[model samples]
Target: MRTRVLAASATGALALTALAVPAAQADGGSGDIRITKVVVDGDNKVTIGTGSAKTFSVSVTATDDSGIAGADSFTLAGPGYGFESTGKPSCKKVSATTSTCTASVKTDPRTDYLSNAMAGTWYVGVWIDANDHDYVWKDKAGSFKFQRGSALTTNASPEPVKKGKTLTVTGKLSRANWETLKYGAYSGQSVQLQYLKKGAKSYTTLKTVKSNTSGNLSTTVKATADGYYRYVFAGNSTSGAITSVSDFVDVK
Candidate 1:
């Protein structure tokens, strides 16, 4: 497999990159190779946390007088991220001329090859070689996007509190760091505190708080009724917004 290292901006934008395609065989005729479908992580959306792995499945329909030997290899490439092998696909013979190939891809921020990959649209490519002849075919498989995700946690101590007593709420905020392929504290960001009555249709924001140096949160509110409390993070360009599961507090 070929390898290259590139860098991305803070916003996850990629720099210029290229892929090298082998020259076609001079005498061998091009075979009929078609990429019917391509699915990444079981869908078109290719979302990955920092330092994560994803699998891809490609369906190929090949028709030729000569028998199909199946796919030779598959590749996933995009802006911010360069060409990385999905490894050789495992093809299952459906008939003399048709087969399906499945493969997996890993993005490790620690590894130099994929350390610069940003979250965005990526293109897939496939190569096929015929068993009966020197004929080979290479074509585009499909496209998908890589997106960052945020993590949030919340806790309300002394769950059962007197109606007029102060209820303490605490939480943390973090987001995927593609450079490290891990979730790190997201500090100095605004997070909303919301509350929902036991049977209410929706939650209403009570106040907004900024995450501290360690991404920790702490605040207090008067206990008035039975309801649920949660924190919502409004994500930025590089990451997607996420909300913590509601923590219930019972008021006497």
Candidate 2:
């Protein structure tokens, strides 16, 4: 999406914070295989109302202190069941004593290929090169799984705001792309607006309102000063942070 950059001071620090499984047997030899940690960035856990092309950074780490004599190579395989993998995993050598690698993947990064894939539960599996068939490293594999929530692809544009004029900021909301949970649980969800003065040190809440049956929400944002203002639309809690801002306006 297109976003307008503003000169407003950041209200607070921004925190940028993925997949799956397989039918592979564990390596009885214990080659120090593991998934160090999983990092989910940009609305990973909560739904923003509209279907979002969430981006995640998955990191996998492997180490071998068993004195195994061989070239320790690793590979990652995800059923991808229905979701899409941005590209091949980006591998890196964290350390000789400890081998580590990381990859960046997204459920749906582009709006062009939305229907080509299904939003469902997917599996991610990691493999180590050893005595395995087809060099598949099936002998040593680890797996994890996660669900994709509902998502919205509706197009939106920044609404124009007049300087010193109070404008009700309103927009649509949708679930995550892989959302399969019953809508009843998430229906009537609310979208929060976070507002702050231009160049201010902190952000304050403007309003909190639930979406209409059509998944639309509206709230007012008062332009405190004539210079500039930016607000974000988010779901759940006061932490509703806006990922983009409206267009700048000349008060005079």
Candidate 3:
């Protein structure tokens, strides 16, 4: 579906600040108006970087006996804060009484001030109205993983080393801090050292190393042939996974 970016700023921010999941979940209205499913970013994993705002799609499927009219708004709440804007739902009829509405929503770095602690599970709050004046409101309709964009970098030393000589690989793991609007170290996480031989189709994991307190990584591997070496981080719940740029080392 076609989607557009919607950022919360100024008045929009002020309005959405009151969004909350009262007692976790609730629904209202007659005629059986109900929210069936909500999909955020396809797999429900939103990864926002320090660059431009990340625009994501939200699909809300609802059913009503009198036919679905549309949705009112969509709010995302997490940790200590929340953000939302009036959803411009594009409704598609699934049946006589069911319609799926989708909208393009976004979390912008320029206006939305988010902290590191806010990266985790976030709940979606919405309201749906039907054609026959029936409506329903849900405080916590669904939830998804909200994560920070992570990055990894690598560099292998000693160019053109002997075939059996040890090559030192060094790198760092960092992620976007939405509040500070900067990339910060992601310390004490396990990262893998992978190698891809020249002319090889894929890379193979050589060994694993954990990032230091400063998110620095250093490891040694015996150079066997001309190949590329890189670092990969399998991220946790609050951060997006990433792979470092491949560094090629030529061996004699």
Candidate 4:
């Protein structure tokens, strides 16, 4: 069973009718059950969009003198407070007394109708039981980013221009708006314009442009050779990073 609770942060008890979860305790363990490490979504970034649900994984590593029996649940609490993983994770034993527990989680905003407040810092809570009747419960086991999805679009005009002529490039930066269930302009953000020769294996940064009040971008560059142009946004605290599709231009 998954438990969803609303809390400003990861602390205190979560009282649900007929199921009173104890106040999250730090390093809760009995006789050698130890939570060694916790990792979220590998790099610790969970990006979700308005179009579809996003899925990620969490791994909890623990050790006990008597070996691990299993875990009760894994709670993901953040700005909006999140999902609780109740089923046992895919368990792999590393040694006589240590095991790594991993589980996958899916997040869909449409189902919950949660607001943008869900994007921010998040924490993980864990409960692992040991083979010898020992158990461990730890809140704030690990932390990760829960960010809103972002997108970038690029367009380069004058498909074929003189070698010395000027070419214009334009694009827009937008991010998912949880409240409206749509993408909205992301203004006042710096996005890098990049270029790649027709057959070049990679792209190089040409210049950086800041999105206007309307989240629109426009820039000009001298045409030198056949190449592709695109815009890349590094993103910020609330939004995920993105790169625009490259637009190709032929130089005469």
Task: Give all candidates' CA lDDT scores.
Answer: 0.68, 0.39, 0.82, 0.81
- Against the hidden true structure, what lDDT does model 3 obtain? 0.82
Per-residue C-alpha lDDT of model 3 across residues 94-156, encoded as one tens digit per residue: 999999988887667657666677788888887788999888878778898888999999999
Candidate 4 lDDT tens digits, 1-252: 132333223456543342344476566777778888888888788787887877788999999989988886687776654445535587789999999999888777666555587788878888888899998788887888888999899999888899989999999999999768799999999999999999889999999999998899999999999999999998776799999999999999
Q: Which residue window of length 10 is worst by lDDT in model 2?
A: 1-10
Clash numbers, per candidate: 3, 22, 0, 0
Instruction: List ranges where model 1 is wrong by over 4 Å.
Output: 1-32, 45-68, 94-98, 113-117, 129-139, 156-158, 161-172, 180-246
Kindly provide the TM-score of model 4 when superposed on the true structure, using C-alpha atoms. 0.85
Off by over 4 Å in 4: 1-22, 81-86
Return the candidate ranking by TM-score, descending. Answer: 4, 3, 1, 2
**Tens digits of per-residue lDDT for model 2 on 2-71?**
1111112366422211122233445443444444433333223322222455555545455544311222
Residues 1-252 of candidate 1 have per-residue lDDT tens digits of 133335554677544444443353222346555455667666555444654444445444455455567666666666653566666777776667666677776554445444424566666666766676634444455776555668999898787999989988999998777666678888999999999989999999988989999999888888889999999987764556789999999998
**How many residue pairs clash in model 2?**
22
Regions of candidate 2 where Cα sits further than 4 Å from its true position: 1-22, 25-34, 38-58, 66-91, 102-123, 129-166, 174-187, 221-223, 227-242, 247-252
Which prediction has the highest TM-score against the true structure? 4
